[model samples]
Target: MERQMEPWWKKSVVYQIYPRSFMDSNGDGIGDIQGIISKLDYLEKLGIDVIWLSPVYDSPNDDNGYDIRNYRTIMDEFGTMEDMEQLIEEAKNRGIRIVMDLVVNHSSDEHEWFVESRSSKNSKYRDYYIWRDGKDGQPPNNWGSVFSGSAWEKDELTNSYYLHLFSKKQPDLNWEHEPLRGDVYQLMTYWLEKGIGGFRMDVINFISKALDLPDGTIHPNNLYGDGSPYFINGPKIHQYLREMNEKVLSKYDVVTVGEMPGATTDDAQIYTNPYNKEVNMVFTFEHMDLDSGPGGKWNVQPLKLVDLKRNFEKWQLALHKVGWNSLYWNNHDQPRVVSRFGNDGEYRELSAKMLAICLHMLQGTPYIYQGEELGMTNVVFPLLEDYRDIETLNMYKEKMEQGISHEDIMSGIYAKGRDNARTPMQWTSEGGFTTGTPWIRMNPNTDEINVEQSINDSTSIFYTYQKLIQLRKQHDIITHGSFQLLFADHPSLFVYKRQSADEEWLVVTNFSDQREQLEWKDCDVTSKSREIIISNYDTLNTNENTVEIRPYEAFVVAFKKGIEN
Candidate 1:
């Protein structure tokens, strides 16, 4: 097939709505499909074309809706099928396309397929999931679940084990089963036919597993092994995606973004290359993973600006010519970015806007999580009992077992817990989200930080995001520019340049709270030809010699037409 023309997804900005936290129309304390439908006008004014709703599928809420029991039905807590249909119609009326989360990496163990597969060894659905004989008297291998403990759980009746990379309630599907692939493809087509614009594939790359089930190498202090090698970007992942593209994706005007935790730019290029027809882009956690300590996500450390700069530059440069990227900092699985990467105290708004600039300046599609645009900081729950995330709870239990202090584990949770980003959307001084009570406690600072306040204040972080999205829509430099990292080793300064054939844009952000001087003379960008385009602070000065930027001050300078002359 010939290359398809540049599509709407490339030009549009996407807003991700974690359905459970966005709003509650029924006063049921949980955000639902109708809640989302009620907020389309708000999203339209924010200028996002695509709305990515996280899974509202039927589930046991074991992993907060990521575990799917029925692929086609809506969760009872969320709403009914008619509510989802109205959501689609209303969003379409407002020029917004809806994209559902595709969670096929695993399904809820309650799903009929898993139920049948687990019933008897000779069942027709037994091969639909990965099953293996126990090794000696233990789990099949040393593989550990991503949530915690062992990846394999033995069925008492069958005396065999089934694999679950996540919670025990979610079983990994067997991609080697051609019939299973057809079923998934058929479900995808069903959604596409219903006017669902596209999909944000959940752990899409993990569908393929290694042919040989081998024990992973063990870490020194670990009880089990790192089982990522057994599933992450395994041998058949690309082939499976290509087949998926040919069968479902390429047939419609749609966009597909795969969530790949351990993939590199080279791997991403193949997954997103237009000619290859696999996906439109891939979300690589290389930049987001910067704050994780060597032990991984639970062990949080200070984020090194140099490391963050390096990773973003590498992916931007690597995918500049070959493919596409989906840029993000806040997501359901991550802590609030402003809390993790920015100063949340006196300079909250300044630092939040600075972080936004630092990422949005890159050449890629940007995703704004539900409350990210309002400069939402992490929730501070003094007691561990206040937290609700399964990952956070599991980590706490494991750390307590390891004899770590309550303060130490809570410190890590404060810095990197997924619950930090899962709080309900602050929509009013009182009642826009819920009437009686919210599912999660509302951040007490909502009076000053909610959507009503942000929308009223012209200088709020919310409006800054609006301007950023508008700029993206109007500028081709954003869509087709090549990236160049300005100062790779700057300790407190993060600077980069985006260049097209005739124009160049320089984005400078001070990641720290200290004032810094830009040695523009160090780079070839002549100061005389540049014009200030965007900045968080009102005043920034560029004299003949040095450009002075204030604490957490951020701005973009664009080289005008014929500046080189």
Candidate 2:
């Protein structure tokens, strides 16, 4: 089957909004859809093409909104469907598209499907979810869910074990069953009919499951999976996605960004290739999961600039050949990239600009998380109790059970907890989000790092992002150009170029704190002049042959067809 070329999401900038933390409308401490609606003007000015909102569906919130009990209804905490429609309408009015989170891998146990599936074996909905008979009165296998424990939970009512790749309250759906798969397609179609511009499919790759139900191996925490090989990227995933794409996604001018953990570029190519017509692009976890270990546990692994540069270059090259890439540094699931990857301690502005240049200059669709443009850092939670994210809480409890001391757990929490990203977005220093208490604690540094502080500052990271986005929109080469790495092996510098035969841009950045000289080697430019398009550092001097970049500095230079420096 030949897939028709259609709307390309690779050319847009997606801004992720964590609704519960964005802003408050009714003084309830929680941010609502109306609040998001009110902020459409701001997003418009920021030049965001799409707004990828986190899940706002009806849920038990055990795993936040990932534990959806009802796919059709908006959560009471978020707003009504009317409010959602209004938000979409308002965003559309301002030229921003809405992409809701699609959490189809699992559903809250309270969902009608799960409710009926657990009641009796002969029920019509029995096959809606994965249920297996207990083996010697135990769970079917030793596979552990992502949050921390057994992937299977025994149901007292039915005397059966059901699969849950996350919290037990959230049971994995049985995609192998035809009717269940049909229901997923129906749900997606329903959303598209309601005018959602796209979907951010959660754990999309895990929808496919391998045949063997065997327990791979056991770890110290009684965890298995380390066993994800059996479940991730299942056989029927492509079939299911193609059906949805053909029936729903392809019908409208819509975009789909799949969130598939533990996927390599080759794996991504199968799903995201436009020729396959499954998904437009996928958010690969390679860059985000750098802190996790092969031991199936979260550990503190600080990413290096050189390593980051290498990984970015590889993905850019690999995807350019087949499909497109969805570029992002911070999303709702990970901590702020400025604090994690860049030097957020002192050279915050310069580091933020450098990181933005590193991602924006790449040949991928860039995504910006709320508060990211302001160079936001992680919140300091003195105690675990202050955090609201369920994954962190589960890991904390598991470590405690394993006899890991409080200090060590706290250290790990400091390094890689989702709560670091879930803190309320700091809108202003005078509590711009709410006069009352926010749904979550604001990062202590919000007083200085808020958007209000960065908006007008010419040297601010926020302005840098604004310029980068404008540059991308203005230049066709930056959008569909070929990327070639220049100083890839250089330890302190990350330099690359994007060219489209007619135009060329040289992007250079100093990843370290100390100053470095960027010597453009082996390239002869015959152009009359090279113009400085954008720079995190000061202006370039005509006298110097070598470009001097300060600590964490970044810049883009536009070389005319025959320019010489």
Candidate 3:
């Protein structure tokens, strides 16, 4: 018998790059593939293993690149196909693989298939999208769009409505159509053959909706109905994924992570289980929604530290050996993590390092959103016109129409808007992103919190991330060790231990501004040979049985199992 080798992705750290905000090479105001190519050395210096590049496919820009108009063509604004290929090659040269964003659940309404599907009721492409007749002059179903209002958009030409789970421009694809599935597989093959590393699937679980297209039940204090039960993790989802794995994913030496919005631990166990051959891992939203109230994402609230700890503990324990988890705190659709989880005002650098240690030491492939390493804070634009995201703008209009005050709506946007993560990366103080005007406003604090300054300063947040990534490469315990939550009920501390047969790594993080004390006895750290592997603080006070933890402090201590005090 032979021991199975761990997958390459298990030990890799992924850095997500929203290309439009990364850099601008041609003074076009939009970051292009060439711009990304120019930053390969910068990414290499950061010690990232993979770059998960958000959608660069041809799009109409309705929902950014998520509403792709063409699957095989590169977006005109980003670059030409040649530039994309150059980017892949250039990144590989520096030992970094490129992972493309796969958004197949929906396509731009201007897509050829959608155009033909709507041209006539008898068209061959009509089955590619979900369409049906209206009932009593209303939409086919009472489901609401994720962006706002109604999910169903009426097509005036065909005298019917097309289902769009997100923006009206993004029409949901009918996976029930065999040819449609085949088309998707063929496009995936097209990319895999291009020497790309893998894919970060976008809202993949929503692909297989119920064929009945039934009306959803309305929730309290909501104008529209909840259709998540019908579409999210719907019937035949597993079957479709199995088919995809068999037809395309399994054929490549590539990793796939599904962005499952409403998946449970049980569902993920099946979706990412090696035996199932569905996806390599899944991006669960449970932790991301901890700050949201019952009303949902726009209804923002402060996050409870215990709740976050328990959530991570659940996923870590559930997927110990059965499945895999893709760990992330910020992405293109979420606000900056330092602003959300840590004190971004006074202790930005310290809290950022602490947060990095908390997530990177966990048992999963960690994803670092661009500029998050520099401790970027959330942007609070004074006027609504400064926002560019469709979801944020739509929510504001809908809420205001319902008599919500400007201050109330702006507060929510300030706290939870997707635009926070979409701001142009602060490479330098003098508009490092573009020579021309940026499509979206840059964070005004870029002068003080830019990548140039962070990279130059050894004590900056950038070095903390670089060190964490390097540590993950050197230590196997950080990646494959068994995870155990310590001080689970602690109000201001997130403490956990990762242990193997002979070595153990204990991670301690103080989530608050006040100083906290940790008695080593509580953590069962009786070993005398324990060493402080990393810490956000300059120094630490420690004895045989106790250690004093400072404000927003974090550190990892490694212990040799057989050592005695």
TM-score against truth, every candidate: 0.97, 0.96, 0.99
| RMSD of candidates 1 onward, in order | 1.7, 2.4, 1.1
After superposing candidate 2, which stretches have Cα over 4 Å from the reference? 1-8, 219-222, 291-297, 522-528, 562-565
What TM value does model 1 have? 0.97
Model 1 clash pairs? none
Reference-based TM-score, model 2: 0.96
Highest-scoring model, TM-score:
3
CA lDDT for candidate 3: 0.93
Q: Mind giving the per-residue lDDT tens digits that candidate 3 earns over 446-559? A: 999998898889999999999999999989898779999998998999999999999888899999998888888889887377888999988777877789888899999998
Tell me the lDDT of model 2 at 147. 84
| lDDT of candidate 1 over 1-565, digit per residue (tens) | 2213677787788999999989888888999988888889989989899999999999999999999999999999999999999999999999999999999989999999999999999999998999999977988889988898899989987889999999999999999999999999999999999999999999999999996888998996678988788789998998999999889988999889999989998898788788888899998988887888887887787889999988988888889868998999999988888888888888899999998888877788999999899998898886887788888899889879999899988888888888888889988876377875777777777877889998999999998899899988888888889998988999999998888888889999998889888777776677788788799988677777679888889999888657653
Indicate the worst ten consecutive residues by lDDT in candidate 2.
1-10
Better of 1 and 2 by TM-score: 1
Q: Is candidate 1 or 3 superior in TM-score?
A: 3
- lDDT score at residue 536, model 2, on the 0-100 scale: 80
lDDT of 3 at 376: 91
Root mean square deviation (Cα) for candidate 1: 1.7
Tell me the deviation in Å of residue 142 in model 3.
Answer: 0.8
Residue 322 deviation, candidate 3, in Å? 0.8
